[model samples]
Target chain A: MTTPLISAAERQRIRSGAHSGPTAGLAPGHVQANLAILPADWAGDFLRFCQANPKACPVLAVSEVGDQALPTLGRGIDIRTDVPRYRVYRDGVLTEEPTDIAALWRDDFVSFLIGCSFSFEEALLADGVPVRHIALDRNVPMYETGIACVPAGRFSGNMVVSMRPMTPRDAIRAIQITSRFPSVHGAPVHFGDPAAIGIRDIAAPEHGEAVPIEPGEVPVFWACGVTPQVAIRNARPPIAIAHSPGAMLITDLLNTQLSVL
Target chain B: MTTPLISAAERQRIRSGAHSGPTAGLAPGHVQANLAILPADWAGDFLRFCQANPKACPVLAVSEVGDQALPTLGRGIDIRTDVPRYRVYRDGVLTEEPTDIAALWRDDFVSFLIGCSFSFEEALLADGVPVRHIALDRNVPMYETGIACVPAGRFSGNMVVSMRPMTPRDAIRAIQITSRFPSVHGAPVHFGDPAAIGIRDIAAPEHGEAVPIEPGEVPVFWACGVTPQVAIRNARPPIAIAHSPGAMLITDLLNTQLSVL
Candidate 1:
């Protein structure tokens, strides 16, 4: 009753309609995932898309067709009710933001849990690398780059990246730290001049608030979880669903378990 | 004999005074090392200096006082004769360049073999990261930075770093690749604007030939093995010796063996 401290407990509270906010600081050491649900027909291509663009969309778990339970990520994880918030999209347009997808659940629905930057951000913070957005109490700046993701059947789009401003020294250490967590956006896709990656204005971003870049600090970028969402939107399927921004599924898997090294 | 194909064979040839030139391409997959031999009286401080500034002076192995063999690095490696060429420093001044130090060998001479950048450069090339200096057939540009090395005893000086221009994408990849070889200078110390590290000119370097930094490429800098040499020169021991520039000690250890991961 005093705000669940464990991932399973937090998920249970969310499932019972108690906690319906962002899961940012919940279950501190556990891995939180971005959610995506699609019809079985679109699942194959989405899976291929995740495989092809792993840095942006590292697939953590895929539920069997129509199954609400993701047994691989955590015990008793009901995809329909476990996430704090969800966005129901029809024909690539957001039609509803629901706390539970039980009413919209279809037998053809397939759920995927993809790696999120939160895991690597935890790592960066643990290593004393300042995450400017988090410190400034704002969202990490998100930019759409000219860099295109490898196409998979019906899924393709330019890679979307989240930027963190840091000095060259911290950026180098962040690269090394994140390289160990390949499942969660891995190392940075690019750093320095954003123009090279096709971002015209460093002060402006397509999504999220732009954090201030102090003098002598360069904006380091990592492929973002929004990238897969972008691909899903571009594919324009009849129906799709994803967790509402910042409202991720708290998984039982410890973040340390994701360090490939 | 036909240009001895292995590291041991090459060492034997160098011992016999047959091969006295730079050892850049010879024994491709094996680890080559920069050499520094100091009298036992000055060796303790030098060892401490290497320990304190590992990234700049990664000590591969240190020899017993008065002993000529470095059994740890390679079998039958006679320190006095294994290196292709040697430079004797008298009171921090260059006094002689000799193929073999048999005449100058002293019972109190303690040899230190330091990890060279060649190992990481090989790793970089293998990963398809273009090393501009190598591609342009010039020495990697080295600069004296305002970044100070942690002082040990009488050894203290600003760090010396070697620069290689690479695209951000390639630089990111290079950082990952080189991070695996911690013994060989590990990852880069700095990148981007040279002025941030107190270098006034990018076109002219204090040591080594300056390679052109192409459009979209950032100059990546790594802690160089020359740092210890600079410190040693400042310490001004009565007598010291080192391998002639680029004429390293060819070791039997494979470069891949140095990978910490």
Candidate 2:
């Protein structure tokens, strides 16, 4: 059968185990969001954390407790099934990676769809600024920083950032371009001297493969989607569910619709 | 004698006196610009230079040859005498710093009012971001960079940047804030590592006083208004005039008017 036109409902149907896999390169131009579902008791603090650290945890859509529909992000998106892969966490420890969460869905759970770097990368590419990771066919390098995110209750951690190698001029232009999309990680939180922010080595990335930094290129970093995941780990909600790294909830919303500017 | 409200009309009337000293703190909230008047023969190349290097030469207003009126930028702005002070150049050398240039105004001259940092600094101050130069009561530091500006005709030189020091968090916010005003040096060109950009010493500024960069504060640099002056000197326009450093041409346009978003 020919690959389907990948609408939001179609993706959700696939996520329901009509199919199951990574969501990258799935829906083009539409927003694919990082997902985090948490207990209602811990939801307030996580919301506050997201608010306090907006760059890292840009909220695209938040669903009511126990409600599966994220109407704003997509038409008839069932958060429990729309995401292709789910990582179950219990007391901050990973418990399982499931294809479907229907059996685990709880009345006290609230879902959040955070803006992803994919949207910004799309924007960067459209603007003619090469995103080194996409060009090299690798994941963007991510690092844990010494810079602390403002704490909210039990949810607190330093920002996690994704790095892109580009010339200083391109970096400046990238900053100007990204600032237009505040919902998508905004601008680079820190650049130059990775060790200054506690990253030990430029080539030795903590999360993803490092791309080649051309001569005269600096590593420009943006607050990452993984940051809220860090806060989730810190908050240690009795039970939490997140989309697997690189696996995301495909939303019908256009990326351009998220720009505050 | 009491200071009249100095309507923009009134200010222009007073400035046409050809003997006013400095134009600082005058025409508050309205945009002020750096003047760089060049011979008509060199105007096309200078225009290309400004286009190629927009961050440094944000041309807010330009005048037709020998016409003193910059109708778009201000009400009845005469390129000849409305600016409080003017510097005359001969063979790329400063020949005079005259208050009035009507005596020296040539029929073949084309005037350019480049956007100045005062507009963005005003925006920053209004946003409650403490500008170190304003706080310490000193001029902002300026330095020549190893970063060569994109060459246009005879106009090509290293960029000159103005520096301000801020903590990383504040720097991030400032980058977001300034990116809104593209006409006025939209965003910072460089931050951290003064040496990386070829500054021999951060404390020893080439042009203005160095404000203290406290512990943990990274130096942020913006493409400066002085950049055009450097290019003008390099281009060696036979008959040119510019505003005395820091003494800009205060216009009737509000700073907010320059913001595209």
Candidate 3:
């Protein structure tokens, strides 16, 4: 069957349990976001963490306490049912992956829609800069860096970065293109030697599949959406939920709307 | 005596041969440009070259043939007498260094005011990023790279790049800051290994003095204004003129005015 044309249509398919796959290439021009749901008591601290470390956790929109709808991101975006898949965490440990989290919805839960790298990746591709992982049909390689995030209450951890192999020329263009979309991780946090940021082995990433770094290409890194997961793990608040990796909340917001330029 | 705060006053001093020194750090917050003058016969090809390779030869203002006044770049500015130093070339050979080019001005001469890296360097320094060469009181090191400039007519040569050694963190910030000012060699061309761009000896530059690269620092290269001079040499126009090394034309245009954002 042909893919749905508009975001609301695609979201309806996801909401109705007709689409449970990763939402990477769906809703071509819209913003797909990283999700984080926390208890209201822990939400204030998490909000502060996002503010303090905007590069990694750029909060696109935040839901009111106990509200499942993110009004700012889309029309009737019911957080509990709109995402294709969800990861439940209890005491900072992964409990289960489910198609829907309606049964586990909490009144005190606050939802945060963090900007995703997909927005900037679209920009890079549009500008003729190659995204290696996307070209190879593999997930972007992510690594845990030694760089520390600014501590906010109980949320603190080393920053996680997603790597994309590129020549220095393409990397420069990528930096310029991505800088326009600060809401989506902005410009790269690091480039060149991976060990400089404490990525010990370039081939073996802490998360995602390894992509080859062709000859004369450096591994350019951007702050990843998984960073908040690290923060969530550190700030264990009894129970929390997030979208399963690659199963982002496909919002009605256009990706171009995120560009500050 | 304290330096004059106004660009017109500074230009007057330069016109009277009172301030015949390096234009760097002078007329703070104003645009200083690399000056290039060619006969009307060779101007079309050179203009094409500048347009084809804007990162290296960003033409901020171009003069009408035989008109020494660059009214667009500054108020009442006479290119022939306002520059602190001028180098005249005959058949691609450096023939003389003159404080004023009024004696050599020809009706067929067409002048171009090209953007200089000084505009972005000011932005970097203001943002608290260390400019190594500025701190050491040395000229920024420039090297000829194997990267070729897009050929326009007879003008063709490898690009020349200016190097700045910075830690990866500061380099990322520099990339963002410089990207805002495209006229001033926007963003870096390459960072990390010098050999990657064909620079055999980082310590020894073909033009400008070498600055020390501290531990944990990588050399960042930007397209240099000297690139056009190399193009001029390759084209070998019978009569061509340029600002001597370190000497530039201080224009009334504020550096911030050059920022695209």
Chain A TM-score relative to the true structure, per candidate:
0.95, 0.93, 0.96
Q: Give each prediction's DockQ, rounded to 2 decimals.
A: 0.91, 0.45, 0.71
Cα lDDT for residue B252, candidate 3: 84
lDDT of 3 by residue, A32-135 (tens): 89999999999999999999999999999999999998888888789999999898988888899898999999899999999999999988998999898889
Error of 2 at A2 (Å): 16
Q: Comparing 2 and 3 by TM-score, which wins?
A: 3
TM-score of each: 0.95, 0.83, 0.93
Provide chain B's TM-score, model 2: 0.92
Off by over 4 Å in 2: A1-4, A8-21, A40-52, A64-67, A75-78, A146-158, A195-215, B1-4, B7-26, B40-45, B64-84, B146-158, B193-206, B210-215
Q: Judging by DockQ against the true structure, name the best candidate.
A: 1
Better of 2 and 3 by DockQ: 3
What is residue B242's positional error in candidate 1, in angstroms?
Answer: 1.6
Please compute the TM-score of chain B alone for each predicted structure, in the order given. Answer: 0.94, 0.92, 0.97
Residue range with the least summed lDDT across 10 consecutive positions in model 2 chain A: A1-10
Best prediction by TM-score: 1
Output DockQ, candidate 2: 0.45
lDDT of 1: 0.89
Clash pairs detected, candidate 1: none
Model 3 residue A46 CA deviation (Å) reads 1.7
